[model samples]
Target chain A: MSHGRRQKPKNLLMILMLSPYLLLLFFFGVLPLIMAIFNVPTKSPSNPNGGWHVIKIVLHDFRLVPAAWHVLGFMALFVPLMIFFVVAMSLMLDTDTAPWKKWVRLAYIVPACISGSVAVLLWYVLLEPTLSPFKGVMHFFGITQASQIWKTSNLTYILVFMAFLSLAGQWILIQFGSLQSISGEILEAARVDGCTQFQLATKIKLPLIRKYVIYMGVLVFAGGLQIFVEPQLLNSSVYHGIAQQWSFDQLSYSLAFDNGNFGEASALSLMLLVPSLIGALLVIFKTDMFEDVNFKSPKKLAKEAKKREAAAA
Target chain B: MSIDFDKKAPATPEAPRKKKRKISIGHYAVNGWLIFWAIFSVIPMLWLILAPSKTDRQVSYKNPLSFASFHGYIRAWKNLQDFNSGVLAHWVINSVTYNLAIVVFASVTASLAGFVISASRIRFKKTFLISTLIMMLVPPVALVIPLFIEMNKVNLIDNPLSVILISSLYPFGAFLSYIYYSNTIPPEIYESARLDGCSDFGLYTKIAFPLSHPLLALLAFFAFVGNWGNYFMPYIMLPSPEHYTLPVGLGALFFSTPAINPGNGATSVPILKPEIALAGILVAVPVMIVFLISQKRLIRGMLAGSIKE
Candidate 1:
């Protein structure tokens, strides 16, 4: 009887705890995503018989698929840049006594705290030749002003930089944390064996943090593929671009709010669910990215490293 | 299996301290590069500070770094004031009210949720964590249209309730809470608490909440700043200028007034540019204060891995 009494309260508490989140998910996430997915049709009000035919028209159009491909192409450019950033951030983390660590860490993080739209606005201001302080610097390099990078075919790189600037910091933090988990004595042992700083960083530190690197790589890769606001805010005409709907998000907004194409908008947004669903799978089944820790005893490592240094002396 | 468990483990002595050496040229070079970037980081802040003093003409004609004219600032101030006969102050009030409400509700709820998920006897832990992670990854922009429609359906469109209620449900806050709860709240404490006849809620309020105060401060800072800096969500939801948050209100003030240039001319001197700059600086202050207060906590979290553990 007592066990039953206790179990009932536990069950009630669980339900009470879950109800709000469940309500939110149903109303906000699941419903919206569902509505977006079902709306892929390019509907015409003139045809009373046009119910499912619009979806067929959307499906038969090869053009829409290529637009998605183009967006994929745009996302591909980020791979090299992210590689460089992750490496630099990792190298900086490996430098234990480097005086610049504080400042470098600050640079790595400030962008994450700063607002994205403000970043868009800042870059917007920076690109304006007559208004920007950089104009004189640009002129000295024989570069003259034009209708900004976003206005041109070079829009891909602009989005790339925006992604790097805003998103790099948190990844840096994550990667740095991962790097810190590696015991310093390992680095010391390598140093005792006459390893240079560069070798210690790339060969030693990089290999140690490899899992975290992969984890962050996949996480950031997934996120970079979801780029919307920077591009949307930077160029208004991105709404009409080939990937216009493949942005999966801006398309949803433009479709629903601008054109009142609720079906197409919802369908486009439903596209976002694919990546998120994949991400969810990765989180659950594929990776232990969240659970495992490389955090060995820092004190032990420090003690060992100190003894090694003293022995070398 | 235990055959005489009296074996004493040997104590280890501290390692000898190595000689401190002279700093190297590489260190200086690194410091120089860092100093250079630190300046780069702070310049925008300096620009934001100085922008409010110039007029539209002077701003275009003079060194863009120079301050804006006083007359134009007053004019912008008056323009801002003229709304609802100074109900612009009410918009500021509303922003503070909404942001604070979000900060408190989000911080507490997320902390509770995070605590339970992290250090609970809960079923379906993996499912909950995955759900939270997926929610975090969905860019807020993608959800705006759907959210708008959803809010409209419920007749909360153009209502502050929409902004308040929607913004309160932050996934990142929950993530932070989970991380802090998992890492900072040691499992042993909970085990002890449960043995002491404490319920799960008692363990949380008595043990977890007190232990996680540092993290709560950190969460509060993030929640406050996130809500404060939000533009698009509030922009989409609130139709009237009376309900405008700082970013949206300032955005309207910026784009509509020709006298306030959106970086068109180097020396064009937009009249309200200085005031716009002032408003921008004002928006940043709360976050800055929060950051300063929680700098140690922020740095700790930053240095901690993806999950707080």
Candidate 2:
């Protein structure tokens, strides 16, 4: 209880220690947002109200929102698909310790470390009609132009391709970590109680890690909405189905960097910021997040396991 | 009458009357799926690596997967080196420099702030902490436009300082550090240290810093790998090829039109499609090596780095 009677730590030392983070937050996070809001330009007798005009422009001309919705819709479709794979893959890997499983797991996770752009580039080479690695398959299917792959009907495949390339390795690692946390005692009990494999996963494993799945789901949903590299890289290709501003981030990038319309870009950025901020807030307050994660040294963990094995024997 | 838990522990769901063949079928099924997935994940990467070694004709209109010639790879490497009078080499150097700076700055700033938040009594603790958590969640894309405007105002655009300075402010690294400290640092030690007349800076330098080796390594790796492969920031900030990182430079080469230099002093001869695949590998191989070396630790760090109890 004496912890409550401690002296206030409002001192220069405290500020000094935290100054780096504070400076960064102020300059990059807070200042940019403030500058963005004011940078928007509106035509008037007295100069004011920049963002509203751009907001209206976005709303009326359907510039930012429609572009955003396609990526948004792509995300909405792909996130669940990713969730299923994450769960299935994690479960399969965890259930057995087969010899080759180790190599397979590493292979699955390798794509995560490399940049998303690399995967896009890899696919870029593979999808070229004349230069595609799967030229034989394409010839067999009688597909002539590279443009045919990204038609509105076939756009889902591209989205799935990009999404899996970027999302699988990272999310799979997280889910696998959570799945491993389940105690062996509980698993043994469920198994002995005549629970089928499917029943065991649905009733036990899935429910136990529900929080992590939700956490990952919300993160992917917000993040997947801002996808840029895939569509942006594809700009050189013949694909017309994906809009110029295929993603909200790309829209902002093109608006400012390409069109040199800093004001409109700033306006569009603020508009997209609203939903992401809210989603973030919801996760922080609602989930059991930001809690401390205590780690044990590998030596200590091994010693404990040895002791448990001895006792069991 | 008591059944031993280990004896009854379920792995394969076997009935006493069931034949052994029935259980083997399930094993095959699981193994089959894993094999299929392994092939799916590895084949693309394999194609990328081998494609770089083939000529333009071999890559597109011919069998690209077959390893035909290191001559082709050597040719592409020479052309990349010779491109724009050795601009790609400069980009590689820039990437190395930027990565080192990002790792050092990000690790120190994030860990220091996280240490204070966890182990010391700081003013506006709640406000500062909440903002830190909230800011990390905001998509970086949402802020690029205004961030660019701010940089342009300061005349930091096209300077490595813009990327280097902002990379230090990484909110995710800060959050990861905070999580590490909160889990590892118990409050009683801080009180005892304070009572022992240990100064604030002394406590951090002597006690906290030594204890955070695992965390520092994790944060440093994430920072290095992330910035190493970052395409957008450098692309938007740097207008000239002289200041480009590998990813940004690669994007400029491949973004709209393929710009593979054909060794004829022409900047846009579009040397065989294999060159593009080679370019992807050039920027990515170093990162992949790091991931492989620290593969196990990488997974462990990710699991522990997140928000949890």
Candidate 3:
């Protein structure tokens, strides 16, 4: 009884601390998801069979295949390129011993500030042959007209380039920061064992920061799947209907707003949500992403270290 | 064995010398690569800044990298001011207000919840942590439609609170803070404070909150930048131009102007290329200012969040 009474106040404090975040999460995160799931038309004259019918309707929509292809193609191009370049650049930044590294890092993040509609606007100006700084290079490729660059066939590349510039810097910084977590002792030992710089980075540093890399991959893949802003801005602003409903998120938006089909929109959104949730869970549980977070007191840590030393002795 | 040892010893020094030469080459190569990418990353922003200084005709015909005159900037600003009787100023204010609210709410709640989750012996802590992780990963685009509907039902569709409240959830910030507090502040400090008669909330206020400046700054910076650049949420939630944030307002400006799309028939409005570029600069400047001021703290915060020990 006394123990139970003693525990009540601590639990109350925990509740007090957690309630604000929990409340916000409930209202914004969990509730919207629940509302979306329930908002899907389980029963209607067009779909008397209910849930499967809604899914079928969404799956069979004429725009679905094209939008799916666009998203898939984008992910195929954007995700791998982003991961490769970010990882490579970050690794290079980590290995390079130069005084200008700080300036380079700052420069990398400059484009990230220009994002969303602004990035699209900036890129439009940058790509327009008449106004582009790289017009000389564009002319070398025999491209003088914006039409050549803004064509439907080249959109995937354009979107990838825009997304890469805006996102790669931050990820490079993040991966570089993760690289900093690698202990110097390990690197010293590798060097002492006659490991070259290349071998040391590949064999030791790469393996050590594998989780952070995977984490980046998962995030990049998920964010890539929802490629909306660049294409949406391109479709609406620079080019008229050139990329209309070019992505699944855009399709969902049109379905909800233009068609006034909230049910179908909700269904489509839930479909996208499922994969992201599954991937997040898989990465969280299957990897050691959170494993190294030290929660023990210093005294307990010291005791464990002593115990390990005694055992080794 | 003695001959082999002597030979190896002599070769070792030479090998290091050769390796030193190779490393310098590699170092220069890396520097060149980073410099190239840096220029690529910064060119568009620099172009945007300088483009506004040229007239629309000059913007297209003149040297793309050259600056024309400050008169073009004054002309663009005047045109922007004339846009909808100066609605751009309202959008700027709205963006600042909404982002500030989001930053404050997100940072405070995230830190408090993170401290509790990491330090307190709370029940279902794993559940909370995993849910936060899942929430972090869930692409927010998936929730927009439902959230719009919910907001509509609550008559918050045109209200700024809808955008602010939804954005303030900031699961990524919460998760980052959780990771930071878990790894950074030792449990002994909390224990010692508690034993010295600090309450659970007191431990957070006294020990955790003051120590988490980098975390708080990071949370604020991210929440500010993410919401500041956010288009879809504010675009959907706030229907009126008066309440529009910078990105959405930029969208409106783009649609109205024949800046990028020459195909769109010319309007009487003077919102040509320079004006549009100026507006884009306006959208980017606040985040760039925040980034410049807090980049060091932002990096330290990122390191704290990602580093294990």
Candidate 4:
């Protein structure tokens, strides 16, 4: 049939457009993952353990527990604080009708320029009393030396501070963007019903944008879980061994490069990857994250068809 | 809801007056909060720019906020040039070349794949989309080792092509493009075009590509910024110092310099706080410039992805 003949070229064109991305994904994204599974560390001849014993080796490693604890502690501080502040600051920004709203948003994003390793450098300067602009504040806390601030126990707070400042601005802006999507008619209705600004924000806007906040939470959690660059750079450059294998990713890196054990490294990486994959799946299925795909559901199509037929009649 | 009623019952006509009084007080509080955080956000960037202008002695002893002269900056630049036979310049070139390649490849492939997935009756569409989503969420840090092994198998480990080809597989960009095309362009346009005998390639080149200027720009800008700031993958892949990107090179500079680790004792080179801060500023300059040029479009593009139509 002509229909069957026409489908061939259409399929060919689709394949043509898709092949480039699909090829890259296959080579880089999909293949490496498969390779990692196969490359999971096995028992050495000297150890004489079982075939799948590398998972046990990675799980029981001394550094593994501490590294996992470090990530959990970081997420504990980061995820909640990020959600609270981003939501609060964005809501406040949305409510303010001042002319300085544009400038405020711009200011929020300025710290983003000092991201990655530069943030680590900048925070060192800020934490070091000798070079910090907020020396008075440090002095008020009865601290006159860098040693007081960069203690081993304070690593969690320090990483959280660096991560928070570098990322909070962008999330605040994104949440503010989410706020803009709320229709004006709803806000106007709330106001006309004599709602205060606080009530309008909390009761209506917060409930409406709950999904966005959850989206932010999932990403922030995932990103925080993979805390590597800050701790790694700090450990290597600043105070040596101060943050050695302080994060899960850093531990995996040390295993592969320093320890020269690729099996244990891949095994540990797969372990770290499981939680993120679960989070991604939860976001995809549990939430309406991809509802904007514009592929109408059957019920929606049926309703639209009904409306069209009514118009024709 | 109770709070709404509590205020609603108190005043009908007088609500505006009461609300105005309350908002002014709350407004000042909000302004105070935002201003305080804004200062926290911007002070480091201001300090980074000014830190390069002061001497090593001044950096430790002088007022942290004060600026001295460009003499120190010029000296730092000269010292950076003198170090390792001027590898910093090579890093700048490598960063630019690698990022530009990624931008071109990511933009073209993502847009094309997105258009086809959304517009055409592609088989296994859900599989492609879900895989892309999973890939987007999979942190690159987790894959670096495996990718290193894969790249080593093909002997492309230290090659710039290794970084470009890997980094350009931006699943997030493809996802954004998929969402943008499907949400913005109605299927009717494609249908009409097909009715008029426009080929599928023609439909993309003449229709989708033309309509995707904003999405393409967004993809390019994000690709540049994201990979420009990337330190880990390139650090793992390109082991040679001369082949380093800006961040890895900066990391090397930090390692050699005694700027942060003052306890390492005196160094013969003049690579001190000023030099390190200068290098940091240099790393941020390109991203800042791009951001400044496309500030409005970038904000709009960000909103376009998250906004539910």
Which of candidates 1 and 2 reaches a greater DockQ? 2
Residue B209 CA displacement from its true place in model 1, Å = 2.5
lDDT for each residue of candidate 1 in A1-313, tens digit (9 for 90 to 100):
9875775776556456655655655566667666554444436442234365555444454545654664676668775677667667546554554454655665555555456445554555455565555667766766565544435466666667666665666566556656655655676677677565567778898887675666556566666665665665544422224234445455556656776666555555555556756765575356665553222243555688799999999
Computed on alpha carbons, the lDDT of every model, listed in order, comes to 0.61, 0.72, 0.82, 0.82
Docking class of 4: acceptable
lDDT of 4 by residue, B1-309 (tens): 000101112224546667668789777888899988888887888888898899889888988878999898899888888877888899889988888899999889988898988888766777888889888766777688889878988999889889999998988888888887887789899999999999999989999988988788888988887888888889889999889998888888767777777666655667888888898988877777776666555555554455654
Report the Cα lDDT for residue A303, model 2. 91
Q: Write the per-residue lDDT of candidate 2 for residues B1-309, one digit (tens) a residue.
A: 011112223454555235335446776787788778777676677787888787777776567668978887888887677667778888889989988998999889999888877776555666776778678777676677788889999999999999898777777787777777777888788778888877788778877889999889888887877778887778777777899988877776664344322222334544445666777787878887787676655655555444232
lDDT, residue A107, candidate 3: 84
Across all candidates, the chain A TM-score values are: 0.76, 0.80, 0.90, 0.92
TM-score, each model?
0.79, 0.87, 0.91, 0.93
Candidate DockQ values, in order, are 0.20, 0.39, 0.42, 0.44
CAPRI-style grade of the A/B interface in model 1: incorrect
Tens-digit lDDT string for candidate 3 (B1-309): 000101111234345677768788777777788899888888898898998999989988988889999998999999888888889899989998999899999889988888887887776776777788788877787688889978987999999999999999977888788877866788899889877878888888888888898678788888887889899899999999999998999998888777777667676668888999998998898888887676655555544455644
Model 1 Cα shift for residue A255 (angstroms): 1.2
Could you give the candidate ranking by TM-score, starting with the highest?
Answer: 4, 3, 2, 1
Q: Write candidate 1's Cα lDDT for B1-309 as tens digits.
A: 011111221221332122113235664565565555556555555555555566555655667677656675676566556643665587689889999888887777777777777665555666666667677655566577667767877899888988887887767777777776766768888878767887777777788877877778877777786788787788789988888887676665544444334343232333255555566655765665565455445544543335332
| Full ranking by DockQ | 4, 3, 2, 1
Distance from true location, Cα of B218 in model 3, Å:
2.2
Off by over 4 Å in 2: A1-10, A41-51, A136-144, A150-153, A237-243, A291-313, B1-23, B255-270, B305-309
Question: Which is better, 2 or 3, measured by TM-score?
Answer: 3
Using TM-score as the measure, the top candidate is: 4
Better candidate number, 1 or 3, judged by DockQ: 3
